[model samples]
Target: MARVKRMERVVALTKQLVDHPYQLFSFTYFCKKFEVAKSTLSEDVLAVRAGLEAYDLGRVETLAGAAGGVRFIPCHSEKANEEFLTELALQLAEPERILSGGMIYMTDLLFKPQLVMRLGEIIAQRLRHLEPEYIMTVETRGIPLAVFVARAFNIPVVMARRVGQITEGSTVSINYVSGSSKQIQTMALPKRALPSSARVLVIDDFMKAGGTARGMAELAEEVGAKVVGKAFFIATQEPEKKMIDDYTALFVLKDIDTENRKIDISPL
Candidate 1:
């Protein structure tokens, strides 16, 4: 193989750090692989960090000492986050996106890999400082978002099911009131899913009254895990009394005019 140029090496190193979010890499590995001096490698790392920050791509951090190394923390500036959400809200506000029962047709948006990846990055950045041990979400719609966030944190994804499954052994089930319907519902999780006293971050695709989010939190309690934070892709403004009060959301469903087939949404 031909020798790689300095610029090429810097680009390659940046990709590796960005792809392996939150994972540390020692300078020794890069120095040996690129056959460069420690001082040269350090300069390359600084250049990569500067580029990421200037372009609002993310952040690169370094540590010094025996256990110290460099790691990439996924994040975008607050202004950029707001701009992205504003554009997304416009697409979501189309009259055709409205459905009966005050529901917005977001299935197409939710499944888009590009959009989901960005959403995960923003949510991960907001909750990353908490140092959550695992990412949890209810089964089905929220699974994709949870998986993306788990990748960002280099952690595992824990799921809760509305109905218990025979394959999952020794399950713990709990009943919570659905905030919208005011009816009791059951949610279950496997006993071995999480360790005792784990710090969990909960992510959901959408929130109406936050009953499902609350139920997942209760289920986490059953396994002795503490909920560090909760986040949502979208949330409705109706049903004034939400089961869960403290949470973060990307979009707020301000109003839905069923008669006129119109919708209003805003970024938070």
Candidate 2:
């Protein structure tokens, strides 16, 4: 291959790092791919990192030594994160989004690949320090969010199902009260899905009474997985007391006025 120019190399490198976030690539691999010297590749990586930081897109971290390389971490600057969340809150506050049961219809938003990926990036940035081995979530709407977060971390996603499957083989099941309906519900996971003492980051699309998240935490415990953190896309304020104690949420649904069809939401 012909030698790649500095600008072209920088652009290509940025795309490669962003596409494979949190995965390390050796310097030798890049040197060969671009037909450039180690010094030239170093300059190229630095330039890409600088551009990403300036734009608040994310960050590129370099590791030294023979086993070292570059890794991309998906995180925005503090100011950028706040601004983006604020805009998202406004979009979610539209009255049309309010449903009859004090719930905001958000399935459409969660299903959008780009939007969910961005939300996942923000959550991954917040919880990356936990060094979770696996991203876990209950089956359904939260699956997309969890998958994107797993992608951001370069890890795998483990899902707990409401109904047990024969294909999953022997499973561990737990019964918990539904936060909203106050009805008993069972959630299960494959016995071999996670190893003992695996660190888990629990994610969900929404949090109301927190029963669902709490149940997931309990399920993780049964499998000997430590629950490092719990995160939600949106959490409601109606149930001030939640089943789970510690958790983070991107947006707060302050009020859903069914009578007036008005919705109030804010970034946390």
Candidate 3:
């Protein structure tokens, strides 16, 4: 039989486990599929996992012992998060993305499907231990991450829209300043939506002064739903500097200067 190129087969196999990373599978099965030894298969998977980390393309997490086997979870290492966020900073450097105000065209990056998918995975990894029953976000920008987290948990995401959509049922409204600009923004949530007992992870794309987070926290409280924690894709300001605390971010865009075209991206 013609032999399969080791790199080609191993990477292919690694990508297959994206859907169910925590499931158990055997080395002998892989050996038969790849026509390689137990030792060679082990080495090949390790190499591929390492390459994945280098590229910031998720992770190759393994399980061991009597009830254990190998699986690949879509997760971000600290380096991976920083690498992806750096790429995003370059995209944000485009002149067209800059708005009339000082705001960079960050909304585009926040809305991109592929970027959102990865960002969602990074958020999911952070909250996986929390085991949130639902994902929550304030309307507009936060919707993307909330959707992705909802998908990861196979649950529905509830949005606190700034203006109540006619489609939303049984609503309650609250007023607070937006974190980015300190402009007062009113956020609304459907009263009947999230059950009071639900444990929710609040998600969004960015946190500047954290006024939006505060608004969401208030909305969550009004519903009697517990805000177990919060997560954001980027934080323009440090959490310590903000009024709110206990949140995780995949990256922070430390600086952005369009004229000199310099930007800083870091993982947290």
Top model number, lDDT: 2
Give the alpha carbon lDDT tens digit for every residue of 1-268 in model 3: 5977876887677766666444446776677878888788789878877887897666766666666657666676677676776776667656566554445667766778887877777678767888788888876777887887776665679888889878877699898877667688788998888899799888987787788888998898888888888888777743358858887877676766666655555666
TM-score of 1: 0.94
Look at candidate 1 and tell me the lDDT of residue 17: 96
Per-candidate Cα lDDT values, in order, are 0.90, 0.91, 0.75
Off by over 4 Å in 2: none
Worst 10 residues of 1 by lDDT: 236-245
Per-prediction TM-score to the true structure, in the order listed:
0.94, 0.95, 0.68
Query: lDDT per residue, candidate 2, 1-268, as tens digits?
Result: 7765788888888889999999999999998888889999999999988998888788899999989999899998878889988988888988888777677888888899998898999899988789988989998999999999999999899999999999999999999999999999999999999888999999999999999999999999998999999999999887899999999999988888888877888999
Candidate 1 or 3, higher TM-score?
A: 1
lDDT of 1 by residue, 181-262 (tens): 8899999999999998999999999999999999999999889999998999998887767889789988889899988877
Clashing pairs in 3: 97-105
Question: How close to the true structure is residue 83 of candidate 2, measured as C-alpha lDDT?
Answer: 90
